[model samples]
Target: MTSTAAPDRPATQPRAPRRRALAERLLDTPLADALAGPHTVDHYLEILRPDWAVKRVRGEILDVRHQNEDSVTLTLRPTVTWPGFQAGQHVELSVDVDGVRHRRCYSPSGSADHRTRTVELTIRVHPQGVVSRHLKAHARRGMFVGLSLPRGEEFVLPTPRPRRVVLISGGSGITPVLSMLRTLTDEGHRGEIVFLHYVRGPRELLHADDLAAIEAAHDNVTVLRVATREAGELPTGWLSGRFGPEHLRRALPEDADAAAFVCGPGALVESVREAFREGGLTTPLRYEHFAPPELPEMDPDQLGTVTFAASDQQVEGDGRPLLEQAEAAGLRPEHGCRMGICMSCKCRLQHGQVRDTLTGEIHGTPGAEIRICVAAAVGDVTVEL
Candidate 1:
């Protein structure tokens, strides 16, 4: 005979009903009505406790560390309501710059340790990126910012983990891979790990000290770094040029069953994919890129029309992203991670065909959900926004 035991709830779970009753009673008071006449509960809460309580998923900047001239890492203490995250997932971060709110997605470059009540994000300031520039230059401790729950499943390790793994990353793509490495090291993973990373030069290296520590502490770990901008002094048989087929072939582990994870720019990711396909190294390969893969130039005849059913308006699809088109047409749709990662701009396609700008694949199924940040219309289409 088998006995099944019920699960135990947290100590705070039992207090929720009591809290709800208290809240109801408090709202019945005349002061509550006076507060509600012109403002919302969030406004009153902000007035009572400005820095801690927020209507959205919020976090306070606890510390900042500069990893390189172009990048900085921020340690954030998130609200208690934040559901925990996996190692390689990303979160949408929102900051207000010059009275305009801008949001972007960034993967935390550290372990998801809930006990510490903190997560870290490493961001590179792009040339023309306003929010990135603000974060790198003016962001300081005690500043509160909005955060989304962890997202993305494409570049993560599989369950029942592989005995041997190869991780490849280029430039800022090292962020998510760093999270995976931190998680593995913390959990005492004894499997063989070969990490190959590429950067412009030594100055641009991300998480250098951490990688060095990992290599020194674990006998099963190996680190190979390549520099693209280094001048005439090459180590014997080491890579010097930009990442290419030769470099990838040298970095691939000898084990045929090893899983491979790659992240980088679209060109780098595609190049690695092609190299893997040609080399017959078919152990499960996963790759992610911030930008869409390059597609052939859109012909003038390929342009289609997009209609918004709710607005009774239409616009010509110029082969750009649907989000850009919608914004140009004066529709302020909720969106985050404009790189097609967060899926915040997803909407139902009521009719006609749409092409994915990333893979150049056409999707036309009725009532299909489409990510507007990366999809473009192929013909006359209607989207329920």
Candidate 2:
């Protein structure tokens, strides 16, 4: 006869505490980010945590797509703590290579879709770019990386979406502009848009498929391509005729309140700015630069000494960036982008003058925040970092 009473419950396992389980699942354990000191816990256990939860904002490479011959687009999945970014904004990505964290800034190339908990960054490998090279060569699906909150103000979607918009992009500078266009398409922006991309050849055209898709889907979208190499008539220095006042006038909507965003190499951005000015298009203009503009010739003899007060290190400064100097002295200082765009290497100038390596501007005011990645000490200096 079968026993009516419940048989011995088959070795049921005890359930973990709700709060503890949640904390572990989210990688929100306290003191997890601290690198040293006895107060830190679970520092060694980080390998077991989900990539997105291990730091302030961690992300894992969900997918990678080769957009063209020289560029690759990476899809990243970040944790919930990542402050949602606006289209045309950039974030700092830190990848650990051989136990060293190398950081760089990249604009998201995907739509600002927070609901999907995903973003994309398209990167082109620079000759001396360590992070870009590694990401292109080795970073693959499921690789965990560190990230900073989105930071950038010069290129964001303007409120009330202007009646007309023109997007000018050069080479790989299309990354952020692509994001803005995708977002506008998703939001059903009713404004007329003129997008002009300048590339050396059709193979060099980044996001050609996406641009074609946007043009096919939206009636108000007009996509134009200016292949500089193909247009041999243009001067060797700048692609002036391809995107000048005449071109703008012909391409942009007439007599409509318009806003223009220019992104790309320094020459392209500057050329577009001049075109806008010459055309007398008194509309809002925004720009983002992938590289520093041509700086005035710096004096080779003008060098300084940099004293790291906290690290108790002193090093002779060269015309190179302070970040590079500090590294040469065997002191590891936090930095990103090395281009001064991300503002990740910002530090206080305790006492001395520093020169902006990009714009050739001087900052003698002590106690001001300076980006060490692009600022060189002008004379004897002391830094708080």
Best by TM-score: 1
Model 1 agreement with the true structure over 336-359: per-residue lDDT tens digits: 877788988999999888888888
RMSD in angstroms, candidate 2? 5.9
lDDT of 2 by residue, 1-385 (tens): 8884455543333344666567655545444444435633334444556552433677888998887655778999886567789989999988878887788899998998555479899999888888888888887898877778999887898888888988888888888888888888888898888888888866687877788899999999988777777644633322333567666775575746888888888888888788777777788789987776676655756677789989989988777788988888888888777778888788999999888876688886778899998888887889987
| Candidate 2 least-lDDT 10 residues | 232-241
Model 1 regions lying over 4 Å from their true place: 1-47, 50-56, 113-116, 229-238
Candidate 2: clashing residue pairs, number? 0
lDDT of 1 at 123: 93
lDDT of each: 0.80, 0.79
